[model samples]
Target: MENKIAFIRQHGIRVRIHALLVDRYLQTYYDKLGWFSDPYEVFRDIVNDPDKHYIFKSILAKTNVSKFDLPNKEAYQDFFGVNPVSSFKQLSSHCSWTGGCLLEKLERAISYDLPGLLSSVSKAAATPAPAKAAPSPPPPLPGTCEGPGCEEKPKNRWRKQ
Candidate 1:
């Protein structure tokens, strides 16, 4: 964990809101900012995308995304990949905001049936952990031998005059 933290820090990554799940669309929300190298790049793509103009908008509209609450690159792809230039609400009639937990919510949002972007995450989670073995006893310390047959330092006898 320390190494991972150090690596992230050394690489100039920041934990930003990657995506806002269920904020507008059921499949719309994401982890809401994660460790990102250039978080604004994500924001720029979304706000600038000609397709995303309706879900996101000018000062006159209520937007589903924010600078801090933006989706990762995958969600953007999937959103557009599924249906570009069309509202996500038309995707389905399911309206359960609180169906799954955070992880499940993320899985649902990103883990597509096809080998899409988040397939790695689902694959990892599905993989079973290796079994653990029992720990062995510690070794004995030095200079503390007291059993029989164990040698002790030689003792000198008194010299005769």
Candidate 2:
């Protein structure tokens, strides 16, 4: 709100905006906010803010980020697509459901205090995780010899002959 008034005051750009037409005025500034008129960019920006993490964090933890780090709008659309990013309200009367919520509150970020959330989400945004090492064989049985060059005898066969 302050930004809109400041920009208007600074540049001397005239707008016939009023209580009802504010949405129209806001739409003009959408590109400047960095969506690049592309939903993929919007998704990218919203996911990284940590505040908006709730909107997509579950998907991040469960799936490879690469599955979503699409290169363009077409690819993003073809992937697990979403509802219109445009219609997502900055403040909604009914926010607890999908495709509706408080944009500012959502993007303001509450995960900074959570190491698991920060590490998983932010690091994944930056790069893929390193591969894990294979597990070592289980410790030898109680009666079996342990350590290098030690081999256990075979159990009795053929009813001890």
TM-score of each: 0.20, 0.21
lDDT of 1 by residue, 1-161 (tens): 44443444333212212223223332323222347634445434553452463443331154332444444446655755555333434223433576534433433443342234334556676898897896896776776776788777666667543
As for candidate 1, its clashing pairs are 16-33, 17-32, 17-33, 18-32, 18-33, 18-70, 19-32, 20-29, 21-29
Cα RMSD (Å) per model? Answer: 17.5, 19.9
| Model 2 Cα lDDT, one tens digit per residue, 1-161 | 44443443333211111111222212323533653466556555543342333323433354333323323324333332454545543333446766655432323332132334555656666895687897998876777667677865677886654
How high is the CA lDDT of each candidate model?
A: 0.42, 0.40
Q: Give the 10-residue window scoring lowest on summed lDDT in candidate 1.
A: 13-22
Alpha carbon lDDT of residue 157, candidate 1? Answer: 67
Off by over 4 Å in 1: 1-48, 51-54, 57-66, 72-79, 82-92, 96-161
What does the lDDT come to for candidate 2?
0.40
